[model samples]
Target: MVTDIIAQAFVDFIRRVCECENLWKAHAKDLELAKVGDEVTKAISEGVEGEYGPVTVKVRKKLLGRREVRVWLYGNEIDVDALLAEISKARSRAAWLLNDCSENALLETLYKYEDRYLIEVAQRNLDKVKNICAGELPRIEFGEAPAHVVEGVVKGVRIYLSGHGTSA
Candidate 1:
């Protein structure tokens, strides 16, 4: 059935979005790592001019406060607050996308696709994937980054940062 085809694509896309969302949520505080990664990488990534720009910087585990955290202050420039805000919005959007664009969403779209032509719906959803793949999503710097980037960083930080905070 056409719905099945569309459903498969939808599930794949939404699952990716879910993984991306979880990654952002895990690094909701570490903007530096969220923007880049734990290692050094440089590329000509710019959706527009006057943005983060091209530069090279290395990131690694550094002791901060009573624990180790990843922070970048040399080689490249980024707004920590801004990055955190983006992470917040990204997290919310990911959850929304997964829920809103789930199998049911695709099924519903399939009806419209059928009414109009299957290609139409497929293109729209595919556009989302393309944008995501190209890192053109709303508030993310890079979407192609592996899903484990943030997850790994968080686990690494939690190894040292978890108990340092006193909340009760």
Candidate 2:
């Protein structure tokens, strides 16, 4: 709790410096925000690691054309990053189902595979998935799935929303 507060304060400090730079753009030296972020991470990391075992703090560069950059504090107890990746894949599948499958077909598919759903996630995430079914389908910005995109089955289809709509 104390560490969280301190971390937030450090984040606020960097944000203020950026705000000042924005106000005096040409006058100000461009702050190496990455270095500042690294220092903040180092400052707070030791206590956190002592409290929780084998913690890693990562400060990432914001992606090009992206608005938000995040700091991640990970504990080595379990492979949380791998777990997050799996859940992210599962959540993407759920969103794909919610968007691509028709209402009747989706309910029937869910009914048929209720056991699969239960095995996949807890109630809170299941509720998040149920809420996903309520929204309008997202217009996919990409014309084709990327080369790195994994192929997987959803509701007996070989891949989610195949172009020809045939099992492969």
Candidate 3:
């Protein structure tokens, strides 16, 4: 029964991790949109500041003549070409920030959330969850016999239990 409970814990941990990740992915697009907008705004503001000495700028996307967006610096039209370049630079910056997250760093963050979620769902002590599913278990043996398989992600590596032992 204890073994069953532990096995269930492992299953539940994996499910929650996947669920959390799916939820994150579903919202990722919205976050990206927000990031792009913020970056564009900052880039335009900085460009305008550099050229016009720190004046407030408002941006509008209209079917303007030969430009992607129109900028109004305190109720006056600014150079459309310059504004377009600023938009391009901002988009590239946002893309780089979104894509440059180190895999290890992202996995570390995921692990922390996975642990928290598992603990909440299992109603188990934090340490116990870490031992069972967080890959702290060197080798899992149940009631004097080892299980056929135990699989999980540990420190950004996938671990699988084999007949001989565990392997990455």
Instruction: Give the least accurate 10-residue stretch of model 3, judged by summed lDDT.
Output: 155-164
C-alpha lDDT score of every prediction, in listed order: 0.38, 0.31, 0.40
- Model 2: per-residue lDDT, tens digit, 1-168? 433332233223223333333333432211222223334344343222222122333333357933322233333333434433433454454444435443343333333333333222212233333322233122222224222211111121222223223223
Could you list the CA RMSD of all candidates, in the order they appear?
19.8, 23.9, 12.6
TM-score, ranked from best to worst: 3, 1, 2
Highest-scoring model, TM-score: 3
Per-model clash counts, in order, read 0, 0, 0
The TM-scores, one per candidate, come to 0.25, 0.18, 0.31
Local distance difference test, candidate 2: 0.31
Best by lDDT: 3
| Candidate 3 runs further than 4 Å off | 47-168
Clashes of 2: 0
**What is the Cα-based TM-score of model 1?**
0.25
lDDT of 3 by residue, 12-99 (tens): 4544444444544654544444444544466564443322322234444447532244454334676756644544564565455455
